[model samples]
Target: MSVNTSNELRLIWVYPDLLSTYGDQGNVIMLARRAQLRGIAAEVVPVRSDEPVPTGGDVYLLGGGEDRPQVLAARRLRADGGLARAAEAGAVLFGVCAGYQLLGEEFAGEEGQPVAGLGLLDIRSERGEQRAVGEVAAQLDPDIAGEMVEGGAPAVRSLTGFENHQGLTRRGPGVRPLARTLTGIGNGDGTDGAYHDHFIGTYLHGPVLARNPALADHLLTLVVGHSLPPVASWADRLHQERLNAVLAGKTRPVCKVQADAEPTGTRRHRHHAPGTCTTSPR
Candidate 1:
């Protein structure tokens, strides 16, 4: 069957068994709702054991999981680099929690071993003994972070979410953060989040997309290519306003403990204004 243009965003959710932490499935529903609001159809494909990863999806989501699941999922993904190729093709890939950890070249588990990654993004994760959990507040880069702010296009209705992770991801050869962890940054070494091209990886939880509609729109834009507009129409505005109101109820205060914990500058890379691209730190 030919793809319908009205709702033509293809999404692939890889390894639910090895992924899916803290109700990550909610993310799928949230994304679909946003797509429907914009009058676009979204197709979400799930990849399990021994399955060949599909190509040409508008976006990919990888969620968090435990040690056993992470090992199994990593093995499956590393055996074939199809996801890497699709990402190289400019497909928007969003990895969260365990999903975020899998996108890196490797993650160092608790035993201090390097687990294989899809090498889709320039970062590495090392497992930690403790889990980073609690509500978080973050300052996003204006250019990339603005749309998610309140009252902005594709606005983020909630500024807080649960961050649950046991490892920290260090910036490898390339990658900037989509948001920072106010406390540990999820990168065991105390880095926040990382970004590369259209790829965004983070440890934040509570169906993050539901709280960050602008991010959902950004992902949808990648999924549909730049052809479709966001849900900015009158009807969409009404829907979003209602959604924002619902989110207001769920909004929690950012953990004050991490507030003063500015992420340590691991690299002396020059800072550039938002929107402009900077080379990944050395």
Candidate 2:
């Protein structure tokens, strides 16, 4: 399971055709930049239409989108069953926003709810008519708590990001939350995100990897498994120092919205639970 740092690490980004909303693409670029900085080569593959989905990738990234697009991606994945197979083969998976929603067993849509998802994780997405838009503080699970010395998970640190979505998620029975929120139930009560084995699904925003590099490293570690090189030790120390400063709000980078904004044609639709036909096209 060793990843050749000199060789390009294959990272597959699925459902890009529908979930390319926002700055999701930035996430992959951020990962690539970080990997290069560490002397590791990274390759990003975007999976859109029904082509053969890649397997055994070092990492899989999925982002958010509108409800219809979400459904279409779900259906496509379901038919191909690429995600499940990849999970079985131990590929690292990261799902964000609607991408996170579609990773669950089911997603409740506005019109016909309870749509089947990739089912890689035991979670469900419901209508969150109320948006969780603003800065937030979260608590990471204890297992990886000690690793948050620097640019790690936001745990207890204020995370600034915009959350503009209407669907919330609930981890299924036996599932665990990656963190407890300081504010909105971004997902369901008792749930904000999840990571089982190499799979990481979260309502966390795009550029999320930029904000949480430690988590990114964790996923890369999982994907590379025993193949990773010995930690430079100094690298960790330096990384932590820089990360802590950022989390401490001592190093804030200017944030700007991108220029690729375009209307998807779908207007805001009312919320509805599982079942019923209440959908209107965008």
Candidate 3:
């Protein structure tokens, strides 16, 4: 599909019911809103699991889901074969968590069985003993960030979000990581996401685009086929505030509290000392 000649863009949100458990639908909403903010008309399309995947969308999104649902979705998607065709036709794809795994060669199933994936990305996932859960902060790959931003360089140094997954993803030959983890376990390999051509897959789920508007704008840029002029909004302020809080917490020192002495009266005094908590500088 060529760039929408009438300034409209087609955005396909795939399998919402099966893959939107973690508020991943917000990514689609954010994309559409960002497009509208930039004066580009966006037609958001929801592709249910049972429906045929459209092969003519400018952007396609797949979100996280439970193990069984992910397996089913993957199978259904493979059967349709529209997504693979769309990618080949220059469609930009954004996949998160389970969605990310399904875009790869394969992912571990509920019983540790292998679930075949779309093979759009040269990565694979395996179940880990521990599930990574909590906030995540990472520095975007400089080269990738450069391409995503307006002036050929990223305005922010890092992107922050929450991650909760048991899958350990590793990049295969020729697959470049989207970012390097500064905090939290990502992919169990220090990398946070994977990207190649116009496809991006990640484990982040602050509905990612909501937490990282530059990334959203980047997706818009991909569909619109031109660099977009920066536009300010209240959402940008909120995103920066949340990012600041996360990064601050990541770097903040921990304090240890101890009783100074046994209680001799009605109350006891307490002593506190700063604990040695270190994080990699952004």
Could you estimate the TM-score for every candidate?
A: 0.75, 0.73, 0.85
Q: lDDT, candidate 1, residue 151?
A: 26
Question: Model 1: residues >4 Å from true position, as ranges?
Answer: 1-7, 146-152, 155-159, 182-185, 188-191, 225-282
Q: What's the lDDT for candidate 1?
A: 0.63
Per-model C-alpha lDDT, please? 0.63, 0.63, 0.78
Quote the positional error of residue 208 for candidate 2 in Å.
Answer: 0.6
Candidate 2: 10-residue stretch with minimal lDDT? 256-265
Q: Pick the candidate with the highest TM-score.
A: 3
lDDT of 2 at 215: 63
Error of 3 at 230 (Å): 0.8
Sorted on TM-score, best first, the list reads 3, 1, 2
Clashing pairs in 2: 2-227, 111-278, 111-279, 265-282, 266-282
